[model samples]
Target: MSRKVDLVADLGEGFGPWRMGDDAQLLDILTSANIACGFHAGDPQIMDETVRACVERGVGIGAHPSFPDLQGFGRRDMGLTADEVRTDVLYQFGALHAIAAFHGVPVTHIAPHGRLGNLVAVREDYADVVASAARRLDPELIVLAQDGKLADAARAAGLRVGIVGIADRAYEDDGTLVPRSEPGAVIHDGEEIRRRTVRMVVDGVIESRNGTLIPVACDTVLVHGDTTGAVVLAQQIRVGLEEAGVEIAPLTDWLE
Candidate 1:
């Protein structure tokens, strides 16, 4: 059977003169674009430009919301409560929604960025906050939890859940992502990513850091657009997946 996957490019990086990522090149390689809302990275102009890029390329667009941390780039953990998460997500999503509206594009999904994303992946309350906030904004919007229990919780909350299957980082038995600071945390080898992603898409399973096989259902695959070799990696992965007969599609298309 041929495999199908949704490849997303993370867009909307930096604020003002401080730029990050090869978003333009990455957009050429990805099917969906996760644009950052103001809090974490991206100003209004950056957000508007990212939205237009997605529209021009026929790529799906989503809000990449994060904690309000420009200096830390939203990588530092803030231990925010559910209420805080709700408020933060609403604020950022609203910003991106307005920009998307201006571009005549509908925001397709919500992917939590950086530390906030990690929090929602494992923390039940935070996941609820994300789902609740999204539902409050628009009940039709999809909430991308992309990991373990949160995926189930998002679904249970009556929100459309997009599971992000392959992890570039490791995960604990409990399913919380292995902190990037930990040893053997992030997987950078191109071959490894290719192999792991194959198993995830074709077999509906993924190997953990301990070499244990775990069941995971994924609707979308995230390719970081802010990385140094992002464009190359995204291109390689797309080519590799296609060569393996895996069909590349956008998350929104898959959901539809």
Candidate 2:
């Protein structure tokens, strides 16, 4: 059977006058959007606009919560206790939920952004707390994380799981996310990204940065919205994947 892939665009630009991503254009190319909440980068206006845009484009909406570090764009790692992580995650996620609700758009899933996302992928205690926050908010909200124990934990807790796979990064043998600072971490070549993603979907496998083939359960594929040429990349990916006979749907369809 041809594998189905959900393309998630990380929408919601920067706060105030400084815009970070081409959210409006990117939305058209993706199946779903991981909308940023206030903690990481987006502002009230940005969130509202993002939600509205998603609704207009018929995109599946999901909360993209992050650590409270807009200055660092939520990519910088700040060591925090597990409880602290949970609290921050829920706080940010809730903001987006309300914003989406206000626009009459039901949030379909929850995807952690930047540092917070990396933390939850491999940290057992931190993952537990973060997953707990999602479950507490709504058991039906799928938690988008690297497809593995994290997804399993969320499922075990009765929260729907969206196994989001990435082509640029890799998971170490210990399950910790490979830091982006490492060499060859980010896949800049568009062809490579497409090839990796195709392999992941068709074979349920991806080559780690360490050159090891690892099994990955991918329901959604994340394309970073902030990167330059991200919109073009998403378009290319969508066209290429569809041409290969892969169905592009939202998180809800895959989870259901």
Candidate 3:
């Protein structure tokens, strides 16, 4: 059977007067969006605007929650407790949920942002807390993550998990991403990224940094919009997948 996957990007990552990536361009190439909530990089205006744009484009909306680390772009470990993590996640999810509701669409999924995203893949406690938060808010919400603790916990909570494949990041043999501090952790070549995305979505496997093939359960692919030439790269990835006969659809449509 031909593979089906969602093309997603992180959006609404702008603060007050400052913006990060060209969200408008990314939105045009995406089937779903992991929009930032207030705690990470979005404000009320950005969140509303982003969600509204998604609604207009028929894109699935997802809440991208993170630790309250606005200055660090949610990439720094704040060492928050379990309850803190849960409440923070719920708080962010609630804010985006309201915005999405106003835009006449539901927040279809939850993807932890930055540091929290990395931790949930490895830390059982954090993963369980995030899963609990998702279950509490909306059991039907798909949890976007790698094949790890969060994926396990979400399934355990009786929620559908959408495995997110990131083609630009280096992965370990065990399916964990290599830490950013490591050399050559992030892949920058556009052609390589496009190739990787096609392989990941069609073959259900990714080549680890050490040249080992690792099995990955990919239901969606995240195309980072913050990189240089990101829009072009995203466009190439979408084209590559389509040419490879992979169906690009929203996770909400096929996650379960």
Best candidate (score: TM-score): 3
In angstroms, what RMSD does candidate 3 have relative to the true structure? 1.0
> In candidate 2, which residue ranges exceed 4 Å CA deviation?
170-176
lDDT of 2 by residue, 60-94 (tens): 99888888888888888788888888888878778
C-alpha TM-score for every candidate? 0.93, 0.93, 0.97
Looking at model 2, report the run of 10 residues with the lowest lDDT sum. Answer: 167-176
Q: How accurate is candidate 2 locally (lDDT)?
A: 0.81
lDDT of 1 by residue, 1-256 (tens): 4667888867888788777898888888788877889887899989988888889989889999999888888999887778988898898999999988988889988888888888777688888778877877887788776665557676777778878854366766655667778998778887788777777777888878887887877777777776567777778778877887889987666674
- What lDDT would candidate 3 get against the real structure? 0.90
Best by lDDT: 3
Residue 253 shift from truth in candidate 2, angstroms = 2.0
**lDDT measured at residue 12 in model 1 versus the true structure, 0 to 100:** 84
